[model samples]
Target: MAKPKSGAKKTTPAGKAGAKPAAKKDNTARLDLIKNASKRVAKATTKLVKAVPEAAKVAKAAVKKAALPEKAPEEKAPKAAAAKAPEEKAPKAAAAKAPAAKKAAAPPAKTATAAAKAPAAKAAGGKASGKAGGAASAPVVPAADRPRPRATKLPPPGEPLTKREMEQLLTAGEGRGVTGEGSLKGRLVLVNDMPNLVVVGRDKRELTFLLQGPDQEVLPAYVDHKVSVSGLIRKTTNHGGVVDVRKYSAKKPEAEVVEVAPAETEPRLRYLSPGEVSMVTAAGMGAGIKGFASIRGNLEMTGEEFVLVVSNGGTRQQVSFLIEGKAASKGLRKHVGHTLQLQGVVDKTSGWGGRISAETVEPRPSEARAVSRDEMELVHIEGEVPTSVDVKLNHGLTVRLPEQPGFTWAIEPTVAKRVGLREANFEPGPNGGPATREFFFTPRNPGTFEVEFFLAKALTPGQVDRSFKINVTVKP
Candidate 1:
């Protein structure tokens, strides 16, 4: 009687255990489901997302209270069954397809989904997949939680492989962890948030690698440009690799270099002012005729324009004033190469040694004293020496300079005023000789004076070709 009762009690428990699958639709299983929901929601809120903690707490409390009667048996049963069920099936389906098919659940998703949608969905996905996997003929194993078969440990990376081994491995598609040195031709590209070398391998299959090196910065400049890379290469994935670049070069044309002209260094052009006119006039080498200076100086052709030679602050500062109006220059045109006092306005333009716009023209009053022929003294000039001369105060003076072709010898107007000029005569040189011009003058006062004559081109008067000076002493 005791044996049968014990047998019956054991039978009842076995029947109850087997009957739980049918009970999945029953009220007890439903309550257990509610408990599972409570746990998942609490984990999702408090542990995973940590969002809506209060709501999760309220839900857990309500579900826990609802599932109190069934929690002890129902909660422990599923977990125990999950643990024991895989052990039973793992040998039958020892070739686990779950590793690949369920690998998605293995890794963490890098980019998060919308928070409101992800937490509950994620909890449901993780918890539900285990249950669903157990039901399928594929056997139950959450890829992340599966006990992996012990693999044969590979040797530590030794020497780099040969080019032939690399070629064969690429063709075989089985070169999982081989290292080698080889040159690869490809277009540099950005992929998977990293710069990669993409090359077409055996059967036109594309191989990719995450590029790394000191020179990786130059990769962007070579994008879409054909490049050759040589270095240590290692196979990380079946068709992918990583290469620590030892060398790289681009098949690109040389960049063009442009030559820029040097910046302008010429000084700015400016006006020659009337203030300089005051210096010449104050020196008695010029005069201010009706408020216009330089009127007393000789009109000479400096270039194409009329210029008045005048002394300026004891320096060779030349002033050129252009005739601004045609009517203003009418009186001055006939006076080129002559000395006179003329009323004019001096204006400026480019490179006319000078031209004054005159309103009226006149012959200047001679300041030379009358001297008779008996008092005249003739002078001869020898080879460029003995430049000093002496004369009686009331006696006439003559100075001469040899003339040559293609150039003209003229007295510097300012220096000429030191020896008052009353007459000038050109004497033709003795038969077939160069001509000589005699400059006859008298000293207006008894003092030492310096005289100068210069040779210059007809077109460029601003430049002097050659000049000579003489010191003359006049004694009373």
Candidate 2:
């Protein structure tokens, strides 16, 4: 085969000789490996079986020992006797010490109990003390802390006095020099530059008292007549008594008195003729007379001077004059519309007006007549009649005539019929010293009618005397 070809080589038939030995060697190696493995397994199994039995035996012994009860050591009789002896004696010893322990705590408990009862005892003591002291034990409050008394309320201001009430107040002496919370019913008048409440006594004597206190503020408003002031009165030596006004009430005038006639010797004025006054006025000329010149006219105010409008028939002229003395301006207002007779000197003259230095100004007297019957006087009251006065057609017009010294006023029948005069009466003075007359008249129709007021002796019945003509214009 070696010589056969280098590439072709050797071949083996079925059941070749070296293949059987190689196979047998592999089988033997495999069987030896399996046997060695089997030996290892068998040895492991045997060791396991032995370990299980030993473990079981050791576990059984542990269980048996755990289940068995433990035995205590026996005690000697002398030690037990000693322990028993102490137990029997302990109660007596504790009993002996308990008193001391309680004694030590007793002071604190007593103190606590005393502290709790002390407040109650003190409260009881306080109640007893309060009862013993009565009102004295009550808390005393300071004057500043005490409740204040309520203030007294003053009465409301009074109503104004009527003309009728003013006459009655002046005549009545009810409230004169009354002191210590009293009231004075009268007309307030200014006397000697001071406020005075003028009242007439039962004897017809006029009494005047000074007005004082807070009422002074309102007293000025009611200068001539007003309310009845109530308060304390203090009498002085020289000046008169004063009233400390506290409250006031409204008053009205009542009850009339007869007016006296004017004096016969009263100065009569010389009025210039209508033609002469017109000619002088048209020429813008003045009389240039320095002596007394009596002029009749209405008084008017211009700036600080007083002017008089003199009318002669249809001719009118304005003359300026200065009032002498310290007369109040308010007193001049009453004569604004009334006719006045002026006595003055023509100091200067101008085209518009003339300046005059006035000595005296008086109310111009009107002509009067007497009536034969008991008929009322139809006095025509006009010009600056207060709007507050109620003027009705059927109602009588109450005219307050100025007080005269010695005269009786009467109405003419013819004049009364024209003015529808109904009644007439007299009232005491509003100024408290003189007497005044009130004439009541009813108008038949609204027209300008001339009525006459006659002045006669007090006892005379039918006598032709001084007649005062009044032009009455009735309004609807």
TM-score of each: 0.27, 0.18
Instruction: Please write out the lDDT profile of model 1 over residues 1-476, one tens digit for every residue.
Output: 55675546454665576564542335564445444433433333333344334333433443434422222333334334433333333322323333332233222211221332455454344434433433443435665855423212333334666777777546537577877766677777877445687788777887886566666656767776677887777788788877777778877644768979989884443433476555434433343322344346544432234445432311233343433445435455555545566555553332323446666656565445345557366554543443888877767767666655534455656666667765544344555366565667777778898877666553234466888888888888
Model 1 local distance difference test score: 0.53
Residue 93 lDDT in candidate 1: 30
Off by over 4 Å in 2: 1-392, 403-406, 430-432, 462-465
On a 0 to 100 scale, what is the lDDT of residue 87 in model 2? 38
**Candidate 2 C-alpha lDDT tens digits along 1-476:** 24667788576776774574543234454445444433433443343334333433433443344432221122123223333333333333334443444344344434433433443344334434434444344466666754433223344444444454434434433433223445667788876545678755545666677777655655656776665877665444222366667867655555578889876882444444555454333324554423345556555443333445443111112233344433424566666545677665433344334555566767875323233324443334532243333344554565655534434455655666667654443344445444455566666577666656665533222443565565566766
Report lDDT (Cα) of residue 309, candidate 1. 46
Which residue pairs collide, candidate 1?
A: 322-347
Query: How many clashing residue pairs, candidate 2?
Result: 22
Residue 254's lDDT within candidate 2 is 53
lDDT, each prediction: 0.53, 0.48
